[model samples]
Target: MQTTAKNALVSELRERIQHLEGGAVRSRTVLPFGVPAIDSVLPSGGLAYGALHEVAGGGSGTVDGAAAALFVAGIAARTKGKIVWCLTRPDLFFPALAQVGLRADRVVFVESDREEDVLANMLEALSYGGLGAVVGELVRLPMTASRRLQLAAEKTGTIGLAVRRWRRQTEAHDFGQPTASTTRWRVSVMPSEELPVPGVGRGRWLLELMRSRAGECAEFLVGACDDKGRIDISTRAGDRQDQTSRSVHSG
Candidate 1:
């Protein structure tokens, strides 16, 4: 009787695995951000794959810029294949990204002179597919340009990330324009948790999920990615704030 029960359990496990691989479990492909508070707000309980997503700094400055970059790096670290990072700026610190889980070895940086060129490179990379993710840094992303990137990502099932960086506050306002991206997020640096020992604590961010295709907008105060590039919701810093405070109208 014991041997028969073990055989039945093994068969059930194998069938479950097959069902997952056959795409019968989830209709749309998604990568869980690993934070339940954030994931629950998304339509598929995670960030959708084969789509374009945008991230921007909360304001115009180095600190805000670093927060946005680290946020994207954390997402890239969780992807499956090689990462293609296209940027016009050469000031990205490798060690900082490493701390967030995106290793230097897995990234291939593509430099361009113009922001337009950076978008072009991202589109090309997304079209090629098989890449873990494609990231681009741009100051201005027009609606038409974003639509192209979205189509390319959809075609190849590759994740495309656009990191918006603006030198001027006026330029940052352009993010309010509509785009073809499936989701839009804004990352702002927050004070780290105070430790009893009086040393540095885990990094923290105010993550705003401003837009989603089918999910409601939400905000999360979350700890930064650990060594494994996994971010967790901070229980100490619960989701505090009204809808008006968290709502970001990215139309």
Candidate 2:
């Protein structure tokens, strides 16, 4: 009789949970990166749609800024529909974005004269609900502005990316401030792999999940996006012997 009662209780609880999760499941859509090591650290094993995320470089140099831009572009490349890129300047190179799978034809670039205009355009694009993703580049993003962006994305089920670039080292510290983004990431360019024959191999990056609302934050050493905009763990990310042992064990 006790076993029977326990089984009934379990069934009742499961039903209640399913009822509660029905609406949540629809709102919390995900886009999986398909990399086990990286996905394991993120909630739902992927990046969340209907949310706003922030990405920044490790430093204030132009190269550092480019790394952050390309990283966001790669994410946008994997999304469906058209991509809207809003920036204060038109200095981004199209070839670099195309190499990461964000083709020129699929992207619409909006140049704004001021930072406020960039943020406004980004929020408007995210609210449209039809675009695959919206990316905004700004030197300073206040907490209130980020919250507005987040709310807009949640309402429209669109993905919003904020690329923070600073001209001075002191201004870079502003990135550490609080924001309403669902996730905050810092990407730094790493040395590319050296081929035994002649040319360079794929680029690598130190991707740091500085803050995340849905899961534990972590760091990863990952290769740059391939032709299809898919990322893979770097060959030198971990100890080779340890990886071999793990592979053998799993096998």
Candidate 3:
């Protein structure tokens, strides 16, 4: 018997399964991080909704990848439409997603045991072009496969997010391999701020824009996502500016 991930979800989002027609023209809008510090670094001035972008953790550990997932979640949460999340792992924590402002109502969870099926589903979802974004957790993405996904996204103008994951540290070397993704990012967990009164402050992250089509590759230290699904850079805005200036190289 064939298995469908949407049919195996909890009650809250179970009925979200629906059909979509391929190749509808959508506005080629972008999802901007809103902070000038971040948006100014992107070629499109924002994350183009109709393109393929890849993200990975700084390490191969599970916690490391979860940070990448949350980063993807925060992006999707800020969009205006529904989302399709294709994953091979069933360990996606709803409460944790909710904590990042990705509510259950806005997502359709598709859980599969095979990575091939997940990849195929991601292509189909992106080709459909009806959702705010189509996110897939992928352990490996070859150049040919990424090219196909990128084309599919371009035709329909949908956000295609590929969350690159690795079970072992050695496998992470594939991240250096070539792909057609427009942008590649590496997010790592950093220590949270320590309050003056002995309390925990907001989480921190080392966000590295590893590669981009027409932007600079830079690293940023910023506060983690807040309840409204925004990454705060106010704390390190000045420092980031200075660093960027010092490292600015002419191509």
Candidate 4:
């Protein structure tokens, strides 16, 4: 049954891609993350063009939310020109973003008090097509608003990410989740898996593919991005071996 569901999801996404291609609608540009695993997951070797992608959480916290922002910004940072970022929250740490590869000079931050205004500005920038990408964050992401942004992205071929801010538990589950976007994902920090060494730990992420226009919903352990902005998969093997050695010693 799970395999059937995955096949169905893939079929649906392929239809959508066909429709776009038949119309000669191209994504104008592809956004790449410095990390290969992430880039491999996205269509066109990056996030879908002319679509709205969403990042939502189930609780109030900065770690997951910040990571999501950096993921989107990291993609834009690799593009040819500057990117636009609109935020309803004022506490965005620019320095942290820089550490993740977002160029300070390529970023344009617009601080707004209302979600509506922020969405409006993001749509406007997405339509221009001159920028690398457009990102926005709000406490809630209404399906209606997300549809509008999706249309604009298609027309302009700009990558759009609408991040849902952490709030009440109920709100986190249902607040304005994106509808028209090509993909919807939920990212959360998982307890780091144990490693052989007492002080060493292996990072893990609970990544849920809630929706995808060009693929099926799949879940995987997204490894952490190293300081150099690369995903290290081999590190997991070393950790597992260490854990086995420690278990033998304890026995």
Candidate 5:
């Protein structure tokens, strides 16, 4: 009887594995970073599955200029399910997140008092395998606890985003820094460009694609996120047109 039960259990496990690999399970996907030029450089249209991505602030003379947290929310809006937002800051401003297309209903917000607790909770959520992605904000130095979260995310294919908030000088000392992540980025606000419409203009972000596993260094001025969490590439389109015009004139 024992031998027969063991055989049945093995068959069930095999069937489960097949379901996960055969597309019976929902495939993990990421939002397109809301920028076409930036998206092209990523391995899988956006941040890859089961990898840590970093975003650092402090450029263009603003602390949270383009708001890295909102960018994560914008990506969450594009994904198909709920997302876990773990942060140390109490003033996250849910209304701002909502404006970027992340519904209040789908977000599980957890405010942490300590960095270690924040990282731990994020790892727990990632291991649950129910979230579309996991976001953690790191404000201080690095901790040994982050490796646990990293391993858990790797095992479950959870896309982890770490936003560094404190300082550019000490960012190298943070838990998510020093080239541990698969991708590292710095987003900052540049001067907004005047659009065709009077008094209506679109902002620009200096997206420094600092590190990636498979792509070379590529940078672009990405349009700011609109109310719908989408970025219109009319600015980039104009640049392309100018390039084409210059080539034609030279030829």
Candidate 6:
């Protein structure tokens, strides 16, 4: 049909634009999730390095946002070199980050009074390169701003993470808009894995891949925050199924 043809042309055009951005698809490094189920659906068989990725909590509450932030922490912990964390708030719990694998010694925190300052600092850190990753607590990631972030990452081979946290639920609507991020994710807290005895166990999360270029959307139920900050595949994953099909677009 004509509609399908139009869509194909649009897709091709986007690819061309991305290719011209100083990063071809094959030039970036890939970070595998280590779970076949999760990695299989990604276009690169893993998250691409030297790119910008978005992460937001499933809900507007602080708990949801914190979980999303911790997920990002775990990722940065696994990478090499130091991590630069730029944020508008000083409330990030260092002890919680340790529980997820990123220790204080490996992190450099940059505090800012404004969201725009935090984003500016993140862009600067990514441009510096040789760091593990640069993280920013963002309320809104405008398309133009995100493109700049992505370009900086691509040029420096650094990974950039925008952990979206908003003051109001209404502000969450902004996340629905498109960005130049290489990947977009939503993370929701789930029940902890059952333990052998009466005690707390490893946390669990329902991770949704909302948008990816040349990749299908997928949901993963996985155990969380190991000593090394990696979220392993939950044994319960087999019991669950994705509510949305692979063809689902941005949500």
TM per prediction: 0.84, 0.84, 0.83, 0.71, 0.74, 0.85
Off by over 4 Å in 5: 1-36, 60-62, 140-146, 167-179, 196-200, 232-251
The TM-score obtained by model 6 is: 0.85
Model 4: per-residue Cα lDDT over 69-117, one tens digit each? 6555555665666778898777778786776567678889988888789
Cα lDDT of all candidates, in order? 0.84, 0.83, 0.80, 0.65, 0.66, 0.85
Error of 4 at 177 (Å): 4.8
lDDT per residue for candidate 6 within 143-222, as digits (tens), equals 99999999999888888999999887778889899899989999888888877799987888888888987777878888
Which ten-residue region of model 6 has the weakest summed lDDT? Answer: 242-251
Please name the candidate that would achieve the greatest lDDT relative to the true structure: 6
Superpose all Cα atoms of candidate 6 onto the true structure and report the RMSD in Å to 1 decimal: 8.6
Cα deviation in Å at residue 103, candidate 2? 0.4
Q: Give per-residue CA lDDT, model 2, range 61-106, as digits (tens).
A: 3334888898899999999999999998788998999898999999
lDDT of 6: 0.85
Q: List the residue pairs that clash in candidate 2.
A: none
- Give per-residue CA lDDT, model 5, range 36-96, as digits (tens): 5667666667776666777765464234424677666776676666788888776678788
After superposition on all C-alphas, the RMSD of every candidate to the true structure, in Å, is 9.2, 7.9, 11.9, 11.7, 6.4, 8.6
Off by over 4 Å in 2: 1-23, 59-64, 237-251
* Candidate 3 TM-score, C-alpha based: 0.83
Candidate number with greatest TM-score = 6
